[model samples]
Target: MQPIFRVQSNLLYQRLEDALQQGLELRLVTQGDRFCGVPIALDEEFIEILYLHVSEDEDSPEEDPYARTVWVIRIAEILAVAYQQSWSRDKLAQLLPTDAATSEVEES
Candidate 1:
């Protein structure tokens, strides 16, 4: 039988593959932080992503439309990976005006 870590890695690979195929945004949790991005490439050791949002500190000062940076995270460093969920229109309609301001809190 394969080792437990190997089995878990295989599962993680499969999930990343599915996410890539579906063009789903993913939230990857690592030891220290989390990242959200669309999978651009995947391999045994790394998953590369086009970041959905780059922080100001990390953002490039030059506004070049053709320039893009791919963020690569080690598969081993990822503790968990999950697709970002979209709010349904019906659910969005139920949200109060103040809900938008509080949305960030919900994630925490």
Candidate 2:
């Protein structure tokens, strides 16, 4: 079956499309009180995010690269899908999260 992918924000959806077309990766950063990051992985229940963490000048080592932090977001928390794409079955199967509803449907 074809898989459905969705992004919640129009701006973020645009950025993701641009990044994919340009062969570039998006970096998630902190903006005032908000946090932004790319969606690296997802499952039926959670989305795994990888965001850059810059250490304070006082705490950062002279040559240290930025750190990456992984955050798990609940699928229910996602507002909507800003963009959708059809993915190969193999790829979709690998990335799609497994959940009780899905399991029940598959079993029946």
Candidate 3:
């Protein structure tokens, strides 16, 4: 039997992503407004959000490199994501973009 992580090839795939992208089965998340759900394709690898992608209107004056988009967040940073399903009105809500956090220590 195929692992549950795998996304089935069917109508769900097309509806999930507008451009037709697929990955391991992961939960979709929405921002403060829970009405709309965003299907997030997660990989074990650490993905980076290039500043170029974000719109100028969204950028804050603080200019944080990581604060612009949704990604794996530490408890101190925001609130719930990936695992934290409990609803918080202000906490930035999003699906777990990655399976694991970025490695701080690199062994050569």
Candidate 4:
């Protein structure tokens, strides 16, 4: 059966998109960092719910764009999100670059 099309109540997407649109860099801790567009498009499942896509960008001392791309991830693996705090300069420094704002987060 086709999933119902609905507006995502995901405050995450709203915030991120707003930040991005306003040219503010958002620090997202995800698996993959790149996507065809948004990790999930409109009318897709998980609408209104903030679903995390694993970013491909693994922060290394070396530059790796492939590591930073974003992909849909399982809910089980996420330990946390940037809910209460932003990434540290150290954390931000470690992130690989996919766009103007995103940085690398090396695997722990």
lDDT of 1 by residue, 51-84 (tens): 7443464355646434455789988799999896
Which pairs in model 2 have colliding backbones? Answer: 7-82, 43-97, 44-97
Judged by TM-score, which candidate is best? Answer: 1
RMSD of each: 8.4, 16.0, 17.5, 14.0
lDDT for each residue of candidate 2 in 1-108, tens digit (9 for 90 to 100): 332345545444455445445444344433322334556764545555667877778765668757887776554454443333566756766676777447745886
User: In lDDT terms, which candidate is top?
Assistant: 1
lDDT of 3 by residue, 1-108 (tens): 533333445333333333214322223333442111233442222221111233356545436433323443111222222322343532322333332222212221
Write out the backbone clash pairs for model 3: 5-25
Q: Model 2's lDDT to the true fold?
A: 0.54
Off by over 4 Å in 1: 1-9, 54-69, 85-108
For candidate 1, what is the TM-score? 0.56
lDDT of each: 0.77, 0.54, 0.30, 0.39
Q: Which stretches of candidate 3 lie over 4 Å from their true place?
A: 5-9, 20-60, 63-66, 71-108
- The estimated TM-scores of all candidates read 0.56, 0.35, 0.22, 0.27
User: Model 2, residue 53: displacement in angstroms?
Assistant: 2.9
Q: Point out the worst 10-residue segment of candidate 2 by lDDT.
A: 26-35
By TM-score rank, best first, the candidates go 1, 2, 4, 3
Residue ranges of candidate 4 with Cα displaced over 4 Å: 1-7, 31-108
Better of 3 and 4 by lDDT: 4
Error of 3 at 28 (Å): 4.6
